[model samples]
Target: MLAKVLLLCCACAAALAAPGVYDAVGYAAPAYAAPAYAHAIAAPAVAHYAAPAYAAPVVKAVAAPVVHAEPIDPNPAYSFSYGVSDPHTGDQKDAAETLQNGVVHGSYSLVEPDGHLRRVTYTADKINGFNAVVERTGAAHGAAVAVAPVAKVVAPAPVAVAAPVARYTLPVAGHPWG
Candidate 1:
Protein backbone atom coordinates (compact mmCIF):
# COMPACT_ATOMS: atom_id res chain seq x y z
CA MET A 1 0.00 0.00 0.00
CA LEU A 2 2.78 2.48 0.90
CA ALA A 3 4.76 1.66 -2.28
CA LYS A 4 1.67 2.27 -4.44
CA VAL A 5 1.09 5.68 -2.84
CA LEU A 6 4.74 6.70 -3.37
CA LEU A 7 4.67 5.70 -7.04
CA LEU A 8 1.41 7.64 -7.59
CA CYS A 9 2.88 10.81 -5.98
CA CYS A 10 6.04 10.56 -8.14
CA ALA A 11 3.96 10.23 -11.31
CA CYS A 12 1.84 13.28 -10.41
CA ALA A 13 4.99 15.37 -9.71
CA ALA A 14 6.54 14.35 -13.03
CA ALA A 15 3.30 15.24 -14.94
CA LEU A 16 3.21 18.71 -13.25
CA ALA A 17 6.87 19.38 -14.13
CA ALA A 18 6.54 18.37 -17.82
CA PRO A 19 6.67 21.34 -20.27
CA GLY A 20 3.73 20.15 -22.43
CA VAL A 21 1.59 19.17 -19.42
CA TYR A 22 1.54 22.84 -18.14
CA ASP A 23 -0.86 24.03 -20.87
CA ALA A 24 -2.86 27.30 -21.02
CA VAL A 25 -6.62 26.88 -21.48
CA GLY A 26 -7.87 26.89 -25.10
CA TYR A 27 -4.30 26.47 -26.41
CA ALA A 28 -3.00 23.15 -27.63
CA ALA A 29 0.17 21.78 -25.93
CA PRO A 30 3.45 22.58 -27.73
CA ALA A 31 4.70 19.57 -29.63
CA TYR A 32 7.84 18.34 -27.94
CA ALA A 33 9.47 15.34 -29.64
CA ALA A 34 10.19 12.28 -27.55
CA PRO A 35 13.84 11.65 -26.62
CA ALA A 36 15.62 9.26 -28.98
CA TYR A 37 16.91 6.02 -27.42
CA ALA A 38 20.71 5.77 -27.35
CA HIS A 39 22.74 2.84 -26.11
CA ALA A 40 25.05 3.71 -23.21
CA ILE A 41 28.75 2.94 -23.46
CA ALA A 42 28.99 -0.35 -21.59
CA ALA A 43 30.65 -0.46 -18.15
CA PRO A 44 32.69 -3.46 -17.01
CA ALA A 45 30.70 -5.83 -14.75
CA VAL A 46 31.45 -5.65 -11.02
CA ALA A 47 33.55 -8.54 -9.73
CA HIS A 48 31.97 -11.04 -7.33
CA TYR A 49 32.44 -9.99 -3.64
CA ALA A 50 34.52 -12.34 -1.47
CA ALA A 51 34.94 -11.96 2.32
CA PRO A 52 38.37 -12.26 3.94
CA ALA A 53 38.65 -15.32 6.20
CA TYR A 54 39.63 -15.05 9.90
CA ALA A 55 41.81 -17.59 11.78
CA ALA A 56 40.47 -19.16 15.01
CA PRO A 57 42.18 -18.10 18.22
CA VAL A 58 44.53 -20.62 19.84
CA VAL A 59 43.88 -21.32 23.63
CA LYS A 60 45.93 -23.49 26.02
CA ALA A 61 43.93 -25.41 28.65
CA VAL A 62 45.68 -26.05 31.96
CA ALA A 63 44.79 -28.92 34.29
CA ALA A 64 44.02 -27.92 37.88
CA PRO A 65 46.51 -28.97 40.58
CA VAL A 66 45.62 -31.93 42.80
CA VAL A 67 44.77 -30.52 46.28
CA HIS A 68 44.96 -32.42 49.61
CA ALA A 69 43.20 -30.98 52.67
CA GLU A 70 44.61 -31.20 56.20
CA PRO A 71 43.42 -34.17 58.22
CA ILE A 72 40.65 -33.58 60.82
CA ASP A 73 41.77 -33.45 64.49
CA PRO A 74 40.57 -36.53 66.34
CA ASN A 75 41.05 -34.95 69.80
CA PRO A 76 37.93 -33.13 71.09
CA ALA A 77 39.93 -30.16 72.54
CA TYR A 78 39.75 -26.88 70.64
CA SER A 79 39.13 -23.18 71.21
CA PHE A 80 37.84 -20.34 69.05
CA SER A 81 36.95 -16.66 69.45
CA TYR A 82 35.09 -14.00 67.45
CA GLY A 83 34.28 -10.30 67.78
CA VAL A 84 31.98 -7.89 65.94
CA SER A 85 30.88 -4.25 66.17
CA ASP A 86 27.33 -2.88 66.13
CA PRO A 87 27.14 -0.54 63.13
CA HIS A 88 24.39 1.74 64.51
CA THR A 89 25.31 2.16 68.21
CA GLY A 90 29.03 1.38 68.01
CA ASP A 91 28.59 -1.48 70.48
CA GLN A 92 31.06 -4.38 70.46
CA LYS A 93 30.71 -8.08 71.24
CA ASP A 94 33.39 -10.69 71.94
CA ALA A 95 32.68 -14.41 72.32
CA ALA A 96 34.84 -17.49 72.68
CA GLU A 97 34.24 -21.21 73.00
CA THR A 98 36.33 -24.10 74.24
CA LEU A 99 35.69 -27.77 73.77
CA GLN A 100 37.34 -29.95 76.45
CA ASN A 101 36.74 -33.67 76.99
CA GLY A 102 33.71 -33.55 74.72
CA VAL A 103 32.06 -30.83 76.87
CA VAL A 104 31.52 -27.47 75.13
CA HIS A 105 31.59 -24.18 77.07
CA GLY A 106 31.61 -20.55 75.94
CA SER A 107 31.36 -16.94 77.11
CA TYR A 108 30.12 -13.87 75.27
CA SER A 109 29.87 -10.17 76.15
CA LEU A 110 27.51 -7.67 74.54
CA VAL A 111 25.39 -4.60 75.19
CA GLU A 112 22.23 -5.55 77.04
CA PRO A 113 18.76 -4.37 76.18
CA ASP A 114 19.09 -1.66 78.86
CA GLY A 115 22.36 -0.42 77.25
CA HIS A 116 24.51 -1.92 80.04
CA LEU A 117 27.37 -4.31 79.23
CA ARG A 118 26.67 -7.91 80.27
CA ARG A 119 28.56 -11.21 80.05
CA VAL A 120 27.00 -14.64 79.59
CA THR A 121 28.58 -17.99 80.43
CA TYR A 122 27.10 -21.18 79.05
CA THR A 123 27.69 -24.90 78.69
CA ALA A 124 26.03 -26.99 76.02
CA ASP A 125 25.99 -30.58 74.77
CA LYS A 126 23.93 -32.59 72.36
CA ILE A 127 22.23 -34.70 75.08
CA ASN A 128 21.67 -31.83 77.54
CA GLY A 129 20.18 -28.49 76.51
CA PHE A 130 22.26 -25.32 76.94
CA ASN A 131 22.44 -23.81 80.48
CA ALA A 132 23.45 -20.16 80.69
CA VAL A 133 24.30 -17.64 83.42
CA VAL A 134 24.13 -13.89 82.79
CA GLU A 135 25.87 -11.21 84.88
CA ARG A 136 26.20 -7.45 84.59
CA THR A 137 29.78 -6.59 83.84
CA GLY A 138 32.09 -3.82 82.58
CA ALA A 139 32.02 -2.74 78.97
CA ALA A 140 34.15 -4.22 76.25
CA HIS A 141 37.97 -3.80 76.83
CA GLY A 142 37.39 -3.64 80.62
CA ALA A 143 38.89 -6.26 82.89
CA ALA A 144 36.44 -9.05 83.76
CA VAL A 145 36.99 -12.18 85.83
CA ALA A 146 36.08 -15.52 84.28
CA VAL A 147 33.13 -16.98 86.21
CA ALA A 148 32.18 -20.66 86.05
CA PRO A 149 28.62 -21.55 85.02
CA VAL A 150 26.30 -22.80 87.75
CA ALA A 151 23.33 -25.08 87.11
CA LYS A 152 20.68 -22.83 88.68
CA VAL A 153 17.09 -23.42 87.70
CA VAL A 154 15.00 -20.30 88.15
CA ALA A 155 11.24 -20.69 87.77
CA PRO A 156 9.27 -18.05 85.90
CA ALA A 157 6.04 -16.45 87.16
CA PRO A 158 2.81 -17.90 85.79
CA VAL A 159 0.01 -15.69 84.43
CA ALA A 160 -3.35 -16.03 82.68
CA VAL A 161 -5.39 -13.90 80.31
CA ALA A 162 -8.87 -13.98 78.85
CA ALA A 163 -9.55 -14.96 75.27
CA PRO A 164 -10.22 -12.23 72.65
CA VAL A 165 -13.51 -11.50 70.85
CA ALA A 166 -14.51 -9.13 68.01
CA ARG A 167 -10.83 -8.65 67.25
CA TYR A 168 -11.37 -9.17 63.52
CA THR A 169 -13.89 -7.98 60.91
CA LEU A 170 -16.06 -10.44 59.02
CA PRO A 171 -16.37 -10.91 55.25
CA VAL A 172 -18.76 -8.53 53.47
CA ALA A 173 -20.41 -8.15 50.00
CA GLY A 174 -19.60 -11.78 49.03
CA HIS A 175 -15.85 -11.05 49.20
CA PRO A 176 -13.39 -12.52 51.75
CA TRP A 177 -12.46 -9.07 53.00
CA GLY A 178 -13.79 -6.45 55.40
Candidate 2:
Protein backbone atom coordinates (compact mmCIF):
# COMPACT_ATOMS: atom_id res chain seq x y z
CA MET A 1 0.00 0.00 0.00
CA LEU A 2 2.86 2.53 0.70
CA ALA A 3 4.54 1.74 -2.66
CA LYS A 4 1.22 2.39 -4.47
CA VAL A 5 0.85 5.77 -2.65
CA LEU A 6 4.40 6.71 -3.75
CA LEU A 7 3.64 5.77 -7.36
CA LEU A 8 0.45 7.83 -7.33
CA CYS A 9 2.35 10.95 -6.07
CA CYS A 10 5.06 10.50 -8.77
CA ALA A 11 2.35 10.24 -11.45
CA CYS A 12 0.78 13.55 -10.26
CA ALA A 13 4.17 15.36 -10.39
CA ALA A 14 4.83 14.02 -13.93
CA ALA A 15 1.49 15.32 -15.14
CA LEU A 16 2.29 18.83 -13.76
CA ALA A 17 5.79 18.86 -15.37
CA ALA A 18 4.56 17.80 -18.89
CA PRO A 19 3.41 21.34 -19.99
CA GLY A 20 6.80 23.00 -19.10
CA VAL A 21 8.67 20.24 -21.03
CA TYR A 22 6.50 20.94 -24.12
CA ASP A 23 7.16 24.75 -23.76
CA ALA A 24 10.98 24.15 -23.68
CA VAL A 25 10.58 22.37 -27.09
CA GLY A 26 9.07 25.59 -28.68
CA TYR A 27 5.44 24.49 -28.45
CA ALA A 28 2.85 27.36 -28.34
CA ALA A 29 1.39 27.92 -24.85
CA PRO A 30 -2.13 29.12 -24.01
CA ALA A 31 -2.65 32.94 -24.52
CA TYR A 32 -3.02 33.68 -20.80
CA ALA A 33 0.26 31.72 -20.02
CA ALA A 34 2.37 33.10 -22.97
CA PRO A 35 4.09 35.80 -20.82
CA ALA A 36 5.31 33.17 -18.34
CA TYR A 37 6.72 30.96 -21.16
CA ALA A 38 8.47 33.97 -22.88
CA HIS A 39 10.14 34.96 -19.55
CA ALA A 40 11.43 31.42 -19.13
CA ILE A 41 13.34 31.21 -22.54
CA ALA A 42 16.91 32.72 -23.04
CA ALA A 43 17.24 35.49 -25.70
CA PRO A 44 19.49 35.02 -28.79
CA ALA A 45 22.96 36.70 -28.83
CA VAL A 46 23.16 40.14 -30.63
CA ALA A 47 24.92 40.35 -34.07
CA HIS A 48 28.20 42.44 -34.27
CA TYR A 49 28.21 43.82 -37.85
CA ALA A 50 31.31 45.74 -39.19
CA ALA A 51 31.63 48.51 -41.85
CA PRO A 52 33.41 47.94 -45.23
CA ALA A 53 37.01 49.21 -45.79
CA TYR A 54 37.96 51.90 -48.37
CA ALA A 55 40.95 51.83 -50.80
CA ALA A 56 43.74 54.49 -51.01
CA PRO A 57 43.31 57.44 -53.46
CA VAL A 58 45.32 57.59 -56.71
CA VAL A 59 47.35 60.72 -57.94
CA LYS A 60 46.86 62.17 -61.46
CA ALA A 61 49.64 63.17 -63.93
CA VAL A 62 50.88 66.82 -64.23
CA ALA A 63 50.97 68.81 -67.54
CA ALA A 64 54.14 70.28 -69.15
CA PRO A 65 55.09 74.05 -69.19
CA VAL A 66 54.49 76.32 -72.24
CA VAL A 67 57.13 78.36 -74.16
CA HIS A 68 56.78 81.40 -76.47
CA ALA A 69 58.59 81.88 -79.86
CA GLU A 70 58.89 85.67 -80.38
CA PRO A 71 61.52 87.83 -78.56
CA ILE A 72 60.05 90.31 -76.04
CA ASP A 73 60.81 94.09 -76.05
CA PRO A 74 63.74 94.94 -73.77
CA ASN A 75 63.09 98.74 -73.58
CA PRO A 76 59.52 99.10 -74.68
CA ALA A 77 57.84 102.52 -74.38
CA TYR A 78 54.94 102.91 -71.90
CA SER A 79 52.51 105.84 -72.06
CA PHE A 80 49.59 106.86 -69.80
CA SER A 81 47.68 110.03 -68.86
CA TYR A 82 46.45 111.06 -65.40
CA GLY A 83 44.74 114.19 -64.07
CA VAL A 84 45.33 115.86 -60.69
CA SER A 85 42.40 117.22 -58.73
CA ASP A 86 41.98 118.73 -55.26
CA PRO A 87 41.56 115.95 -52.73
CA HIS A 88 39.91 118.23 -50.13
CA THR A 89 37.46 120.12 -52.37
CA GLY A 90 37.33 117.73 -55.36
CA ASP A 91 38.10 120.57 -57.81
CA GLN A 92 40.84 120.79 -60.47
CA LYS A 93 42.39 124.00 -59.01
CA ASP A 94 45.94 122.79 -59.70
CA ALA A 95 45.11 122.43 -63.41
CA ALA A 96 44.17 126.10 -63.63
CA GLU A 97 47.25 127.08 -61.63
CA THR A 98 49.39 124.98 -63.95
CA LEU A 99 47.94 126.80 -66.98
CA GLN A 100 48.60 130.23 -65.46
CA ASN A 101 52.15 129.34 -64.37
CA GLY A 102 53.04 127.59 -67.65
CA VAL A 103 54.69 124.80 -65.65
CA VAL A 104 53.92 121.11 -65.09
CA HIS A 105 54.85 118.60 -62.40
CA GLY A 106 55.47 114.99 -63.46
CA SER A 107 57.90 112.06 -63.35
CA TYR A 108 59.67 110.20 -66.18
CA SER A 109 61.86 107.11 -66.59
CA LEU A 110 64.13 105.87 -69.35
CA VAL A 111 66.58 103.10 -70.32
CA GLU A 112 70.16 104.44 -70.91
CA PRO A 113 72.18 103.67 -74.05
CA ASP A 114 74.46 101.48 -71.92
CA GLY A 115 71.44 99.40 -70.75
CA HIS A 116 71.09 101.34 -67.53
CA LEU A 117 67.68 102.65 -66.48
CA ARG A 118 67.34 106.29 -65.25
CA ARG A 119 64.44 108.31 -63.86
CA VAL A 120 63.91 112.14 -63.73
CA THR A 121 61.24 114.36 -62.17
CA TYR A 122 60.16 117.97 -62.81
CA THR A 123 57.57 120.40 -61.50
CA ALA A 124 56.24 123.23 -63.72
CA ASP A 125 53.39 124.95 -61.90
CA LYS A 126 52.28 127.33 -64.69
CA ILE A 127 51.96 124.80 -67.51
CA ASN A 128 48.58 123.58 -68.74
CA GLY A 129 47.78 119.90 -68.22
CA PHE A 130 45.62 119.55 -71.35
CA ASN A 131 46.45 116.95 -74.06
CA ALA A 132 49.87 116.16 -72.61
CA VAL A 133 51.71 113.15 -74.15
CA VAL A 134 54.76 111.47 -72.63
CA GLU A 135 57.09 109.14 -74.54
CA ARG A 136 59.82 106.95 -73.06
CA THR A 137 62.47 107.38 -75.79
CA GLY A 138 65.35 105.36 -74.30
CA ALA A 139 66.71 104.50 -70.88
CA ALA A 140 68.13 108.08 -70.68
CA HIS A 141 65.36 110.55 -71.42
CA GLY A 142 61.58 111.03 -71.96
CA ALA A 143 59.69 113.77 -73.85
CA ALA A 144 56.34 115.46 -73.05
CA VAL A 145 54.37 117.16 -75.84
CA ALA A 146 51.26 119.26 -75.34
CA VAL A 147 48.84 119.26 -78.28
CA ALA A 148 45.67 120.99 -77.00
CA PRO A 149 43.17 121.58 -79.83
CA VAL A 150 42.33 125.31 -80.22
CA ALA A 151 38.64 126.34 -80.19
CA LYS A 152 37.37 129.32 -82.31
CA VAL A 153 35.02 131.89 -80.66
CA VAL A 154 32.34 133.80 -82.64
CA ALA A 155 31.01 137.21 -81.29
CA PRO A 156 27.27 137.89 -81.15
CA ALA A 157 25.56 140.98 -82.82
CA PRO A 158 24.93 144.07 -80.59
CA VAL A 159 21.37 145.19 -79.60
CA ALA A 160 20.14 148.86 -79.62
CA VAL A 161 19.13 150.64 -76.33
CA ALA A 162 15.76 152.52 -76.02
CA ALA A 163 15.56 156.24 -75.00
CA PRO A 164 14.22 157.28 -71.56
CA VAL A 165 10.66 158.85 -71.33
CA ALA A 166 10.25 162.53 -70.19
CA ARG A 167 7.58 163.78 -67.60
CA TYR A 168 6.22 167.42 -67.05
CA THR A 169 3.93 168.76 -64.31
CA LEU A 170 2.21 172.18 -63.62
CA PRO A 171 2.98 174.04 -60.36
CA VAL A 172 0.16 174.19 -57.80
CA ALA A 173 -1.18 177.34 -56.02
CA GLY A 174 1.79 177.53 -53.67
CA HIS A 175 4.30 180.40 -53.13
CA PRO A 176 6.57 181.69 -56.01
CA TRP A 177 5.98 179.27 -58.90
CA GLY A 178 2.24 179.85 -58.95
Candidate 3:
Protein backbone atom coordinates (compact mmCIF):
# COMPACT_ATOMS: atom_id res chain seq x y z
CA MET A 1 0.00 0.00 0.00
CA LEU A 2 2.41 2.58 -1.16
CA ALA A 3 4.88 1.21 1.29
CA LYS A 4 2.59 2.04 4.15
CA VAL A 5 2.15 5.58 2.98
CA LEU A 6 5.85 5.96 2.42
CA LEU A 7 6.61 4.69 5.86
CA LEU A 8 4.15 7.17 7.31
CA CYS A 9 5.85 10.03 5.56
CA CYS A 10 9.29 9.11 6.75
CA ALA A 11 7.96 8.87 10.25
CA CYS A 12 6.44 12.29 10.08
CA ALA A 13 9.61 13.79 8.70
CA ALA A 14 11.68 12.20 11.34
CA ALA A 15 9.32 13.38 13.99
CA LEU A 16 9.56 16.95 12.81
CA ALA A 17 13.32 16.82 12.77
CA ALA A 18 15.80 17.48 15.57
CA PRO A 19 16.05 15.49 18.74
CA GLY A 20 19.65 14.34 18.38
CA VAL A 21 18.74 12.22 15.31
CA TYR A 22 21.80 10.95 13.47
CA ASP A 23 20.76 7.23 13.72
CA ALA A 24 21.73 4.40 11.26
CA VAL A 25 25.00 3.88 13.15
CA GLY A 26 26.20 7.47 13.15
CA TYR A 27 24.94 7.33 16.69
CA ALA A 28 23.74 10.63 18.02
CA ALA A 29 20.35 9.39 19.25
CA PRO A 30 20.35 11.48 22.37
CA ALA A 31 17.14 13.05 23.68
CA TYR A 32 18.44 11.92 27.04
CA ALA A 33 21.92 10.97 28.13
CA ALA A 34 25.38 10.40 26.53
CA PRO A 35 25.16 13.67 24.63
CA ALA A 36 28.86 14.22 25.25
CA TYR A 37 29.26 15.50 21.69
CA ALA A 38 28.17 11.97 20.57
CA HIS A 39 31.72 10.69 20.28
CA ALA A 40 33.03 13.17 17.77
CA ILE A 41 30.86 11.89 14.77
CA ALA A 42 32.42 9.37 12.29
CA ALA A 43 30.54 6.19 11.23
CA PRO A 44 29.73 5.67 7.55
CA ALA A 45 31.21 2.69 5.67
CA VAL A 46 28.78 -0.28 5.74
CA ALA A 47 28.09 -1.28 2.12
CA HIS A 48 28.25 -5.13 1.71
CA TYR A 49 25.91 -6.44 -1.11
CA ALA A 50 27.70 -8.22 -4.07
CA ALA A 51 25.38 -9.99 -6.61
CA PRO A 52 25.61 -9.09 -10.34
CA ALA A 53 27.57 -11.17 -12.90
CA TYR A 54 25.89 -13.23 -15.67
CA ALA A 55 26.72 -15.58 -18.62
CA ALA A 56 25.00 -18.98 -19.15
CA PRO A 57 23.45 -19.60 -22.55
CA VAL A 58 24.60 -21.87 -25.38
CA VAL A 59 22.74 -24.53 -27.47
CA LYS A 60 23.29 -25.97 -30.99
CA ALA A 61 22.11 -29.07 -32.89
CA VAL A 62 20.55 -29.13 -36.36
CA ALA A 63 19.88 -31.70 -39.13
CA ALA A 64 16.72 -31.83 -41.18
CA PRO A 65 16.43 -32.08 -44.99
CA VAL A 66 14.90 -34.99 -46.88
CA VAL A 67 11.85 -34.59 -49.05
CA HIS A 68 10.83 -36.25 -52.33
CA ALA A 69 7.27 -36.08 -53.48
CA GLU A 70 6.10 -35.98 -57.10
CA PRO A 71 4.42 -39.08 -58.40
CA ILE A 72 0.66 -39.19 -58.63
CA ASP A 73 -1.63 -40.41 -61.41
CA PRO A 74 -2.69 -43.92 -60.70
CA ASN A 75 -4.51 -44.21 -63.98
CA PRO A 76 -6.31 -40.92 -63.54
CA ALA A 77 -7.99 -39.36 -66.55
CA TYR A 78 -11.44 -37.85 -66.72
CA SER A 79 -14.32 -36.67 -68.83
CA PHE A 80 -17.79 -35.55 -67.81
CA SER A 81 -21.08 -34.38 -69.21
CA TYR A 82 -24.35 -33.26 -67.69
CA GLY A 83 -27.78 -32.15 -68.71
CA VAL A 84 -31.07 -31.18 -67.14
CA SER A 85 -34.09 -29.91 -68.99
CA ASP A 86 -36.44 -28.87 -66.19
CA PRO A 87 -39.37 -27.27 -67.92
CA HIS A 88 -40.74 -26.38 -64.49
CA THR A 89 -40.70 -29.95 -63.21
CA GLY A 90 -41.06 -31.92 -66.41
CA ASP A 91 -37.50 -32.60 -65.20
CA GLN A 92 -35.62 -34.40 -67.94
CA LYS A 93 -32.14 -35.74 -67.14
CA ASP A 94 -28.89 -36.76 -68.78
CA ALA A 95 -25.35 -37.76 -67.78
CA ALA A 96 -22.10 -38.98 -69.32
CA GLU A 97 -18.70 -40.02 -67.98
CA THR A 98 -15.32 -41.51 -68.86
CA LEU A 99 -12.07 -42.40 -67.15
CA GLN A 100 -9.18 -43.63 -69.33
CA ASN A 101 -6.59 -46.08 -68.09
CA GLY A 102 -8.86 -47.64 -65.50
CA VAL A 103 -12.00 -48.01 -67.57
CA VAL A 104 -15.30 -46.56 -66.36
CA HIS A 105 -17.43 -45.42 -69.24
CA GLY A 106 -21.01 -44.34 -68.41
CA SER A 107 -24.29 -43.01 -69.66
CA TYR A 108 -27.63 -41.97 -68.22
CA SER A 109 -30.99 -40.65 -69.29
CA LEU A 110 -34.41 -40.10 -67.78
CA VAL A 111 -37.96 -39.05 -68.50
CA GLU A 112 -39.98 -42.09 -67.57
CA PRO A 113 -43.25 -40.91 -66.15
CA ASP A 114 -45.06 -42.97 -68.70
CA GLY A 115 -43.26 -40.67 -71.12
CA HIS A 116 -40.75 -43.47 -71.86
CA LEU A 117 -37.12 -42.59 -72.67
CA ARG A 118 -35.20 -44.24 -69.84
CA ARG A 119 -31.91 -45.22 -71.43
CA VAL A 120 -28.94 -46.28 -69.25
CA THR A 121 -25.58 -47.83 -70.09
CA TYR A 122 -22.42 -48.45 -68.09
CA THR A 123 -19.14 -50.24 -67.57
CA ALA A 124 -16.27 -50.53 -65.07
CA ASP A 125 -12.85 -52.16 -65.09
CA LYS A 126 -10.59 -54.50 -63.03
CA ILE A 127 -11.85 -56.99 -65.58
CA ASN A 128 -15.58 -56.59 -65.78
CA GLY A 129 -17.07 -55.37 -62.54
CA PHE A 130 -20.25 -53.48 -63.31
CA ASN A 131 -22.41 -53.15 -66.38
CA ALA A 132 -25.82 -51.63 -66.86
CA VAL A 133 -28.25 -51.69 -69.77
CA VAL A 134 -31.76 -50.39 -69.59
CA GLU A 135 -33.61 -48.99 -72.58
CA ARG A 136 -37.18 -47.79 -72.87
CA THR A 137 -38.12 -45.63 -75.79
CA GLY A 138 -41.28 -43.61 -76.48
CA ALA A 139 -44.64 -45.43 -76.29
CA ALA A 140 -46.75 -44.01 -73.45
CA HIS A 141 -47.68 -40.42 -73.96
CA GLY A 142 -50.77 -39.40 -72.06
CA ALA A 143 -50.19 -38.49 -68.42
CA ALA A 144 -47.25 -36.20 -67.65
CA VAL A 145 -48.10 -32.55 -67.32
CA ALA A 146 -48.21 -30.91 -63.96
CA VAL A 147 -46.07 -27.82 -64.32
CA ALA A 148 -46.82 -24.90 -62.01
CA PRO A 149 -44.06 -22.94 -60.30
CA VAL A 150 -43.63 -19.41 -61.51
CA ALA A 151 -45.01 -16.69 -59.35
CA LYS A 152 -42.79 -14.09 -57.69
CA VAL A 153 -44.21 -10.60 -57.92
CA VAL A 154 -43.47 -8.42 -54.90
CA ALA A 155 -44.02 -4.74 -55.53
CA PRO A 156 -45.55 -2.55 -52.85
CA ALA A 157 -43.27 -0.43 -50.76
CA PRO A 158 -43.30 3.17 -51.83
CA VAL A 159 -45.02 5.49 -49.38
CA ALA A 160 -43.67 8.63 -47.75
CA VAL A 161 -46.23 11.46 -48.00
CA ALA A 162 -45.66 14.44 -45.75
CA ALA A 163 -45.83 17.78 -47.55
CA PRO A 164 -49.06 19.68 -46.96
CA VAL A 165 -49.12 22.47 -44.40
CA ALA A 166 -50.92 25.46 -45.94
CA ARG A 167 -52.58 27.84 -43.45
CA TYR A 168 -55.21 30.55 -43.77
CA THR A 169 -58.15 30.40 -41.37
CA LEU A 170 -59.16 33.83 -40.24
CA PRO A 171 -62.87 33.62 -40.84
CA VAL A 172 -63.72 33.03 -37.22
CA ALA A 173 -67.12 34.07 -36.02
CA GLY A 174 -68.40 31.36 -33.77
CA HIS A 175 -66.03 28.54 -33.99
CA PRO A 176 -66.10 25.46 -31.84
CA TRP A 177 -63.62 23.42 -33.94
CA GLY A 178 -64.00 24.87 -37.41
Top candidate when judged by TM-score against the true structure: 1
**lDDT string, candidate 2, 1-178, tens digits:** 9999999999999986764545544555444423346357654443333333467899889888778789876544433444445557433211121222244545555444343444444454334333334443444224444469899989898898988988888866667755
Which one wins by TM-score: 2 or 3? 3
Encode model 1's per-residue lDDT on 1-178: one tens digit a residue.
9999999999999987775443433334544454455865554453333344568999989999999998987766989999989779767799999998677999999875455688899999877879999999655454455669999999888788787776787665765674
Clash count for each candidate, listed in order shown: 0, 12, 0
| Model 1 residue pairs with clashes | none
Candidate 3 or 2, higher lDDT: 3
- Superposed on all Cα atoms, the candidates' RMSDs to the truth, in angstroms, are 16.7, 31.9, 17.0
lDDT of candidate model 1 versus the reference: 0.76
